[model samples]
Target: MDKEVIGPGACVLRGFVDDPAEMVRAIADIAASAPFRHLSTPSGAPMRIAMTNCGRVGWVNVRSGYGYAEVDPLTGHSWPSMPAIFTRLATHAAAEAGFADYTPDVCLINRYTVGSSLHMHKDRNGFLKDMPVVSVSLGLPATFRFGGQGNGEPPRSIPLVNGDVVVWGGPSRMNYHGVLPLEAGVHPLTGNTRFNLTFRAGVVKPAPRLGSKTG
Candidate 1:
């Protein structure tokens, strides 16, 4: 795998996964346990991307706000456990990006089709700030926007394809980033869709102040 530093605390490892098919199969199993759904935003609008979670805690957005939960509100059951392979891949990628002893406790899986995209945003839901985020891309391709910590300036666009892994932390931890709208395409392995796995380490803190955000 070729690793390139994209920012102070971020790097992308091109063709990191030798066998993406195996990962795809594993994802199928995970989805069977915790089905993907369009989670609602705080504003009550459905998210554009389909999402599910695996591991001890999963990212969630509800009327209450953004946070992590052990149980899927849709099913009232714990999210599927993080597969061993998933943990290893995330750790290895993080370590390669200069984050040592990285242990992520949650994996957020996002599914996107043509026209699906994530808006530029900071990953600041959890109490832990600046935790390293390891993202693996599979199936299709998309443009990634990497921006400065502040939102005023425009972002740099990068293309992410299957088997590519990107790790962000350190000085780039709080930098804004997002995926641009996907174009229509098909991949031999994933076909008509793209799957992105983002791993994060989080610890639930006390409820926020009245004016602060809540999950």
Candidate 2:
């Protein structure tokens, strides 16, 4: 993955996916197992885009609050593990961004339509401060808002195309970021919806075993 420094502690790697078709197909199959659903914020506000999870820890929100859980609340089962392809991509992207040996345990799959957009926010999953968030964009085009910590200054609008990967870590790990409303367009592969897979390394907490007897 050839890296292009976009900002201080931010980088973009182009054409990271050798076979975008295979990646798309893999995602579709994974989604069939774990369907996408729009998640609600802790404030009870519904998110714009529908999302799914394919990893050890799936990000979820409910009346309780926002955080990562080992089990999928919708299914009462553990979220799907990250595919080998996704792991490879995550490692390569992180390396390009100067983050060595990154193995993300959480994979957040987000789906977006023409009018779908994400509000600017930082990821606070309680991981190492230097672990980068590797985001892979496929399907439709959208403008990504990249800003400094806090909401003081205006963010730079970065155009993301299909097969592009963005990695943020180090001083920029907590930087605020989000996506603009997706533009109406059809990709030969994804057809209509835009697919974004964000890879994040989350702390692992052992879950209780089923049918275990306690003294």
Candidate 3:
């Protein structure tokens, strides 16, 4: 895998995952149990992307606020376990980006279709901000903005295609970032949708075994 650095402690690894089809099946099995839903923001506005999660903790935007929880609020059950492939891929990517011993306990899976997007923002939710975030991209391509720590700085737009993984930490962990509106098109793997799996290093909560069924 070729590691390309874009900023301080932020880099991209090309074609990091050897088999995306297997990962897709794994993700489908997970979504079959937990399912994916459009989440509302803290202010009651619905987000553009549909999401679900697998791992010790899942990121959620609930009626109360945005946070992580051991259970999925929608179904009253625990999130699926972080697939071994996911953990292995994330750890390898982080290590290639200079972070070792990355024990990711939260893997948030976000799905985006045409017109889906996100505004620039800093990630302040992960428990271990000191650790790097390992993000895996699959399916459709999208433009990613890597910005400065402050809001006023202009962001650099980078095209991210399938099988690309990014690692961000250190001085760049708090840097502003977001995705541009997705273009209307279909990728062979996922049709018109894009998938982003972000892994954050949080304390483990003993995730359920892989392929466990939930209502």
Candidate 4:
């Protein structure tokens, strides 16, 4: 795989996935247990992208706030167990990006179609900030915006295609980043859809059971 350094402690691994078809099948199985749904922001605006998760914990956002939850809010059950292939890819990608022994507890799967876009933002939830974030792209191609720590700096738009992986940590760990609106496209593996698998070290402590009182 070819590597391109986007910034300090950030890189893009071109065509990192050897078999996009296998990965797509895995995603379909994971989604079968934990189906994708649009999560709303704090203001109650539904995000354009449909999201789901697999692993010990899943990232969640509701009217109350955003954080990691041990259970799927929709089904009131634990998220599907992360597939072995997902863990292997994430750890290997993180290691290639200079973060060794990286083991993510959660994998957030984002589904985007034509016109779906994600606004620039920093990832600062309950996850361990020291760990690197590994993101894998599949299906249709899209533009990925990588920016600096401050908002004043203009972000660089990088074209990402199927099997491309991006990893960021250390100095670039908290940098602002997002994906631009997806233009019309049809990919053989996924038709008009694009799937992104984001791996992160989620909350260390187990979230309180739903509806349970906590201090």
Candidate 5:
């Protein structure tokens, strides 16, 4: 556990797990199943980032609105299962950040290119806000905005690179956080886009089988 406490309830772990390359491979396999798509917000503006997911559940938003879904709305199939490697990394990172027995059921895969950014927001789809979200960054580099727990507070920007893991929970669970627009670059392993895998405990319902159903 390469741990560094970056804030009151935020932390960064460099090379948090062994075999970072293998982790990227596993993520690729997962993405192959669901493929990546530029999702839309409730207001209709397309998200700056392209995304896909792997795990028991995938976070999605469509004409119906934002929520956890069993299938990828685009492929009409279930997203890939959360690989063991991902589960292990999440658990390890969580334990290092002082939360033990953390098993994440949802793995949100976000892809960012130059000028792609995520607005400050909170993760509220899960049951427990106190469980902490473990985010792993790979390929390229980006600035992460860390704001106070309140929505209106000004946020601090932190730079992140490949193999960097950030965890936020407890009082910081409600902290408003996001990624600033990424700069264009080539990461040997991931190329022009920044790959991020965020682990969270999703809802309990069973996810549909990929290639087996369509909405």
Candidate 6:
């Protein structure tokens, strides 16, 4: 796989997964256990993309707000365990991007169809802010908009195809990123859809407040 650096602490590993079919099968299993659903934003607006999770904790957005929960609100059960293939790929990809010893406890699976798009936002809920976010792309291609720390900053568009992996942390941890509206397309594995697996260290204890004492 060819590693292309996109920023100070971000990179794209082109064709990282040689056998995406294996990963696609695993994702099917995960979805069977935790079916994808559109999570509502704080404003009560339903997000365009459908999402699910597999790990110790899953990212959730409810009327209360966005945060990680140990159980799925929809099913009242723990999210499906993270599959070995998902964990292995995320760990190796993070290491390849310079973030070593990365073992993600949460894998957020996003399903995008034509017209589905994600708004630019920073990943700030995870307490392990030092760890990198390893994102793997599968199926139809999409344009990734990566921006600076500021909310109003214009973003640079990057095209990502199947098997592409993007990892970012350190200096670029809080940078804003999102996916543009997916266009019509069809792939052998996923048909007319796209899947994204975002691995994150979601089980860490919350960091102490600025003035809080720690041993």
Error of 2 at 168 (Å): 0.5
Best by lDDT: 4
Query: Which stretches of model 5 miss by more than 4 angstroms?
Result: 62-64, 151-153, 202-215
User: What digit string (tens of lDDT, one per residue) describes model 6 on residues 41-145?
Assistant: 666667888989998888776334677777777777889999898999999999999988899989999999999999988998855789899999999999999
Which segments of model 6 are wrong by more than 4 Å? Answer: 151-153, 205-215
* Backbone clash count for every predicted candidate, in the order shown: 3, 0, 0, 0, 2, 0
Worst 10 residues of 2 by lDDT: 206-215
Q: Over all chains combined, what TM-score does candidate 3 have?
A: 0.91
TM-score of each: 0.92, 0.90, 0.91, 0.94, 0.89, 0.92
Distance from true position, residue 178, model 3, in Å? 0.3
Worst 10 residues of 3 by lDDT: 206-215
TM-score, ranked from best to worst? 4, 1, 6, 3, 2, 5
Model 1 lDDT per residue over 3-85, tens place: 88888888999999877898899899999988888876667678889988898877776446667777776677888999889
lDDT of 2 at 45: 62
The C-alpha lDDT values of all candidates are 0.84, 0.80, 0.84, 0.88, 0.80, 0.86
What TM-score, to 2 decimals, does candidate 1 have? 0.92
Which residue runs does candidate 3 get wrong by more than 4 Å?
A: 203-215
Which residue pairs in candidate 5 have backbone atoms (N, alpha carbon, C) closer than 3 angstroms, thus clashing?
55-82, 78-210
Candidate 4 lDDT over residue span 47-157, tens digit each: 789999999988776335666788888778989998889989999999999999888899999999999999999988778889999999999999999999895888999
The better-scoring model by TM-score among 2 and 5 is: 2
